[model samples]
Target: MRLPCIGILTISDRASQGHYEDKGGPAVETSLRAILAMPFEALRRCVPDERPVIEAALSSLCDNDGCCLVVTTGGTGPAPRDVTPEATEAVCDRMLPGFGELMRMESLKQVPTAILSRQTAGLRGRSLIVNLPGKPSAIDLCLKAVFPAIPYCLDLIGAARLETDPAICPAFRPGK
Candidate 1:
């Protein structure tokens, strides 16, 4: 069977320009590796915090590359350049607001500034696009907080089936 294709997108001005090493992309891969029980291919990309660039990358991943899920890190902040959410919203046909809401609610337990996060998730074609904060720690936290619903969401969207390790993050699926 062909492995499910998943995209790891890192949006950062410095990382995309090679000025700073990209930790968020790898961080997302690592976290997913630990949480996912099924085999999959992780396609990684780094782009500057430009809306057009981010949107194009997202389109390529979902429309061209056929990524079942695209999880992005960075550009979800209050900064003017933080446009991941906007780009995702533009590319996605339907927006899933509960993801950002749950992530923020969970993150608020750790830091008061969690309210500043603008993380979100949406669906583009059959692919699920999720936006996450830039910090590696926050990436892990937000992913864990929201990933429980990811598999079922994929099932609903007709993407590739994704299962999670019960020891890491047990996925929720009704009557499964």
Candidate 2:
């Protein structure tokens, strides 16, 4: 089987500048590695919380790098620097609002501050981009909530086919 190409982007001014360690990006990588049973490769990037930079990175990953799925961490809060969602919307061909809604809804069960999160997901060409919060625990929570449909979404977008371990993350697809 061909390996799936995935992009992992971390949007944080401090982490990008090397002022702080990036916990969220690694969390995403670990989660994907643990759950995805298919052959896959990840292209990782760390950038500051700037809309233009994020937009450029997203475009390059989806268009140039040929990443079927681009998962971004950080810049989903109410802060002015939090423009990951805006950048994602700008580059994507369509918005998948259900992802953000479901993430927030699931996270609300954990923390009341989930209302402040603006996590979102979208599609650019054949690539699916998901904006996630910076916190590592929040990453785990959000991924668990929405990842069941991600593989199928990528399949529908003509990007790649992703198979998951049923015991770890049983993906929900019709006629499974």
TM-scores of the models, in the given order?
0.98, 0.98
Off-target runs (Cα >4 Å) in candidate 1 are none
lDDT (Cα, tens digit) per residue for candidate 1, span 83-165: 99999999999999999999999899999999999998999999999998889999899999999999999999899999899
Give the whole-model CA lDDT for all candidates, comma-separated.
Answer: 0.96, 0.93
**Candidate 1, overall lDDT?**
0.96
Deviation in Å, model 2, residue 40 alpha carbon = 0.8
Report the alpha-carbon TM-score of model 2 versus the true structure.
Answer: 0.98
- Candidate 2: tens digits of C-alpha lDDT, residues 35-127: 898779899999999999999999999999999999999999999989999999999989999999999999999999999999999999999
Please list the residue runs of candidate 2 whose C-alpha ends up more than 4 Å from where it truly belongs after superposition. none
